[model samples]
Structure formats: C-alpha cells, structure tokens
Target: MATFGKYFLIVWTILFFNFFMETQAPPSCDHGWTRTPNGEACVKMYIRPPKAWHSARRACRDEGGDLVTIFDETKSNFVRDILAVNNTTTAWIGFHVILTEERWHWLDEDGTPNYTNWRYGYPDEDFWDPMVRAEECAIAAWVNGLGAPWINYVCFVTYPYICEKPLPSKCQWNDTVCLNIHETYDGWKCLKGRDGVARIVWPETYPPGSSGPIISGYALPILRSEKRRRDLQ
Candidate 1:
C-alpha cells in the first residue's frame, strides 16, 4: 500500500509539471521571421529583385511560408506597416479574383473575402470588359493623401512581396541552462529538420529523470517503450 501511494504521487507530480510547462509556453517565430505586434502571424519580406505574383509566392514557399494574406483590418495594417517600414512603395498581396468567378479571394486556406481595403475607383471590374486586361492581383500602395490601400494590378507585374506563416512552437526545454547562450545543451548538437525547423539532437547519455525526448513543452509526451522501439530501428 505504501509503495502504491508513492508511485501514484510520482505519476501525479510528473503530470502536473508537464501541464504547467505547456500552459506557460508561448508562440515563437521561425528563424529570420518576425512576429506581428499583435502576435497574429510570422512575416518576412522579400525586397530585392522583385518578382511577379506567382514568382513571389514561389519564393515565399521556398522559405516554408506563403504570400501574406490579410483577412481583417488588423492584418491589413500589420502588412501595411511592414511595407511602410521598408520604404516599399508597392508590393503584391495575396488578394485576387478567381478568373472563373468575379468574387475576390485570398490565397490562404480561409479564402473567403471577409474584409477588403480597396482604393477608391479600384478593382475596376475590368474583367467584365472583354477588351481590357483583367487586373487579377492586388497590390498595397501608399497614396499621398490616403493611407496605404489595396489596388488591383495584373498578376505578371513585378513587385516586392511579403510572406506569412503560422508561428512555430519554441523548444524551450533544455537539459541544463548553460551560462553561454549559444550552447543551449551541454553536449548535444543542433540539427535542422527537413521542414527547415531546428531541433536539438539528443545525446546517448541523458540526465536522470528524463522520461522522453523533449520536442517542445507543448507537445504530447512520448511513451518510453515506443521511444526505445524507435531507437532500435
């Protein structure tokens, strides 16, 4: 009975510690990305040698993100500030009209055009007129009197672009806090995952009480038996 009570207490303590760690974890941005002031999303801008809409998106995807999409006024302002800070007069955004339908859509999974910041007399609805070239893509531009608003443009035109991706979990779990900041772990080496994410390699020897790999504080605990099976393979 005493042994059973001791084991139950140990299990309960471990569960409590894990829960506390997870609840305290905060969202983190990937390397070379900046989080918005409101903590909405991680964003990065490609300014040099501007590319067309499709090319810009491709470039963004290479960095594990997609062209910035603004679903609301807050996101619109966040992207606008990024462009403004960089002195980018104009840049391609993710808003566009699906050629088959006149309705506008965003490049993000939440494609519904719930919000817009169109400039006056813009979008032109030129798609309706067979003689005019369709202005399928949107660009955020600064007007002398008006603040930055979206303007429709042809998709092929080259412009600076912004990319946005969801914030990745910050791996704050380390065996020991070394005095040297760069040396996050004592003897383990850092490795980059295929998805361009950084992960700390676990050394063969581990400190006492290490039940499983510490992927992140927010991740679910992996069973020790399963981990041993994986190690064997």
Candidate 2:
C-alpha cells in the first residue's frame, strides 16, 4: 500500500505540473492572431456581418494582406473551426473564377498555394440559381456549425470574412533597411535584430547608376542624367 501511494502521488504531481505549465504558456503567435492548432498559420475572424466580398478583400489589403487563403485540409479545418466558434455563417476566402478567364485563382498578395478545398460539386457557378453575374466569390460555410463546406458566394453579398497572413520569421521585425551599410563587402555577413538573423550584404543585384530594380523596403532612384549617361556610353 505504501509503494502504491508513492507512485500515485508522483503521477498526480506530474499531471499538476503539466496543467500549470500549459496554463501559463503564451499563445502561439501575437495577441491579435490565433495560431492554428496544426501550426500552419495564424487566423483571425471578423464577425462584423454585411461586408461585401470586395469590401472585405479591400479591408484585408489595408491590413497588409488579402482575404484568407487556405492552403490545405489542415488550414481549411482550422478556418472552419474559427467560423463555428464565432457562429459566422459564411466568410470570404481569397479565391474567385473570373467569368472570362473561368479559372479559379487566389487573389492574395503572394498568390495561392497549390492545394484547394472545395465542397463536393463546388464551383458549379450556377449555385443559388443562375443570375447573370452570380457566384464569383468563395466562402467557408458553417451555418450549421458542423460539416462546413466551401461554397460559392455572390460578389456583392455581405458576410463576415477571414484574413490569413504568414507569421513574420525571426528576421522580419524592426525592418532595418538592408542598404544602410556604407560599403557592402564580400563575405560581410553579420547577425542583426533580436532574433539574431544573419544578414549578408551583397552588391551583385544593385548595379551602379541603375535603378531598374527595386528592393523591398528600400527606395533608390537614379537620376535621368545617370540613366542617360549609361545609355550614351
């Protein structure tokens, strides 16, 4: 009896420590976002209804992203769970089939992932009875809170929308201009930022007196005279 009691106490202590540790652990991402249980991407659900698909897309763009772009079943399930939790009947995703082009594509800033999740018999284009210009948007439908399916929605209709964006890597924050160095030398790699991401300075892409290329977060404009000097030479 004594040995059994000691083992039981050890198990109870381990369980208590695990529960306590889990309770104190921070959320997977920043406060505003909910990291997917599968650790795919952070997701957010906007419950304000009556937002047109275009309006929702523009709103997401203003937030530095487009509408949520689900990559696979894991992300789809996570997003559907968000809708169920928020009781959102429908929410826009970053997809549409232009009538003229007639090929489904992602409208997100960085383009779509290869995977797709569609309700069986989806993209019918004639759902809800064919009007002249109906069913140009895609939505996650969880009106029943279970067995959610991706369905086509009218572009003008209003519904809550989901916006998804990739979490910043260790090196993305504080965004120091990669061009601030006086003279970039070969093999000049050094750690920067709190995450200690190694940044290497290379001038291979930045040609002297040429501004045809634009690097993200930096603006280097060459004067017309400089461009003309190269042209003449």
Candidate 3:
C-alpha cells in the first residue's frame, strides 16, 4: 500500500508540473539585441560615429556586454553577415594580441582562438614586437570581391563595433530542479537543508503529505533535459 501511494504521488506531481509549464514563457534576449541562431549568445551592432577600439569596447561594457568574440567559423560568418547587412566596411571585435602570451585572444576567453578567419598575409607580424604589442587590435573587414576576414590594425583607429553578451540561462519554471543540480545555477542560490544537502520547498499544491522541503536528488536528469530542449529551440 505504501509503494502504491508513492507511485500515485509521482504521477500527480508530473501532471501538475506540466500544467505549470503551459503558462510559463521561454527565455529571451533583451530588447535591441538578437539571440544567435544556436541560442548561445546575444549580439548587437553599434553604428554610431566610429570610436577607437578601447572606447568602443567601453561602450559595449556600459551596455552590459563586451566586444564580440568569434569562437569558430559559424560565429565568424554570423558576424560577417551582420556587418554586410549593416553596410559596415569594418568593425572592432574582441580579438587582440596578448603580448605576454605571444598570441591573439578574445577578451572574455582564456585561451587563444581555436579557429580564425585571417585575411591573406595578415595578423601582420610587424606589431608582434614587444614595443608595438599595444597597437595591434583586430577588425572584421570586407575587401573588394572577397568575404569578410579579420585584419590586425592599430588600436587607436576608430570603427563601429559589435557587442556580444551571454544569453539568459535562468530556468523558466524549473529553477528548484536546476538549483539542486548545478553549482552555477543562474536562477537563485541554493540553501543548506536540514540533512546538509541542497533542497527547496515543495510547491504547496503538490500531493498532500509532500508539502515540506525536499532533498536534492542524486541526479537531476530533468534539468539536463530542459537545458537540451532550450538549446535546441
């Protein structure tokens, strides 16, 4: 009888969860920004009078983002298309020389670029010298009859720029489930429970005897599944 009661409780919980989902909205980007097709980040192009590389990056920071970082061919192409669509000839990206590391790196990333789209005979070695290291900044530019490609330029040169920020990852309605699973849960901080495990209060509407706080599960496959669904959407 106890086993039957537990089984019925699980079924009822799932039903209520599904009903709750029907009224919840999916995660979204801020106004004036567009989410990437793969949904990993948000991007916006600033077309005001061109600003120097540092100034442009500062503007993006003021808007809660940093200059865009292109990680691979897909992101490179996406940035190119955006520039082409905006009639922009060139724009500052986040890539810049790390003099100490002797390699180019994105502002928000630790490692050097795994993929790059350098134009012919570019990323000029001239500025790699220690004295000129501060001068080399990267830009995406369109050449006559050629696709957009990156070129190293002096940091003081003014150009419109692109800004990119991470997409919101807060679970739409599964925060309690996600908080118990990932240490980096974006929704809310987890609280220590009586048993020294992470836990959350059960929804008052759940099965009658289940109104108290519940312990974190050994695994939260539901949260993982939700993340996959969000990424795919």
Candidate 4:
C-alpha cells in the first residue's frame, strides 16, 4: 500500500546510514544534536526546567528521536559529564525498572542492558510512594546523593531530559531549493524513480524538472538520496 516514492525513501535510508555511523569521519552533528567523538549518536539536552518524564520522552520522539538511552560505560560517563557541566541535578533517560522482571531496560524494550550504572541499594523494589506508579522510571541522577549516578524516580515527576538520534552525513548540492527539500525529508531527494524515469521533487518550485526530460548521470545521486530518505522516514 505504499507509494513508489515512499518505498525508495525507505531503502535509501538504510544504505546511507553508514556514511555517518561507524565511520572514520562524520563531518559534524546535525542542526541540534551534539556529535560525539565516535559519532555513534547525536545527543541534545532539553533543560526546559521540568516536565513529567513521559512527557519529556514524547517531546524527544516528536523531534524524530527519543529520550537518551545510555548503552555502555562510555555513554554513561558522557551523560554524567553533560549533567556535571550544566550543574543538572537529574534528568530522565529511556529507562525504567521492569518490576515484573526486576531488571532495568530501555523503555523501547531493547532488552536487559549490557552495562549498568545503578546507585547502590537502589531500585529496592520495596521502594514505593503514593504519588508514583510502581517505580517504573529511571534518572541520570547527580553523583551526590546515594553514590552512583543512576537511580529511579517517579515517572510523573518533572525533570529536564536529553534526547538523541543518529547524525546524518554531510551532503552538498548546488540547488538551494533541492537542498532545502532534501533536508526536510531527512536529507533524501528523489531525482528519479525506479521505473527509469524522471521524478522531480517539488515540481511547482522547479519547472523543467526531471519529468520534463531525463538527464545523464542524474540517477546516481537521486538513488543515493532516495536511500537515505527511506531509512529516515
């Protein structure tokens, strides 16, 4: 039930990911995300004072990413440093204690974390409060309180948060309108369709477009852009 354009976008997205991820070079972070040394992910802090953890997560998702999820010690330390630098007391992350399983995991259910940074004697399972719902959220706690930097907090509690998503590769095109269109669609531009025909994007904006006449050497860039677009979409 998907359109041809939509299908091409999906495929390109998957292929172009390597240009930024696991790369020897990533150029730089996107407009908002902060690029790390390894360029594994782009992260941003949302220090709008406070919002319920759930609402904070939703905000991140709306921005085409999700609440921060610390997957390893390096990432954990990086997050802690961000907090320390900003003098943040605590922030929501994509994590919660799975009370039924008695284990911490990303809210996306990526499975039990290979690494953990829990505060000692915490997540007691025995911990409870009338205002909180069954102890189902975690925070990047300040390193002052009970020891470690990770702890559980009420899901409804308002707290600043971090959001993260993968960074995109640098793409330069001479056409400004084409550039804007590509950026809008996760950096993918459909220059051609799979049917060996011109597939000009934003036809109203650009007349004498692909639909008008097929040009030589146009397929490659279009195909590449379509691939990235699909993955991001």
lDDT (Cα atoms) of all candidates against the true structure: 0.65, 0.60, 0.69, 0.62
* Candidate 2 residue-wise lDDT, 57-174, digit = tens: 8887776667887767777777878877887667888887666555678875344348877777886656434466564888888745445578886788888888775553322233
Candidate 2: the clashing residue pairs are: none
Ranked by TM-score from best down, the candidates are 3, 1, 4, 2
Tell me the TM-score of each prediction against the true structure: 0.65, 0.55, 0.70, 0.57
TM-score result, candidate 3: 0.70
lDDT-based ranking, best first? 3, 1, 4, 2
Tell me the deviation in Å of residue 22 in model 3. 2.8
Model 1 Cα shift for residue 49 (angstroms) = 0.7
lDDT at residue 40 of model 4 (Cα atoms): 55
Candidate 1 structure quality by residue, lDDT tens digits, 39-80: 746998878999999999889888777888877777777777
Model 3: which residue pairs collide?
none
User: Using lDDT as the measure, which candidate wins?
Assistant: 3
lDDT of 1 at 143: 69
Looking at candidate 1, what is the lDDT of residue 72? 73
Best by the TM-score measure:
3
In model 3, where do residues sit more than 4 Å from their true spots? 129-134, 169-233
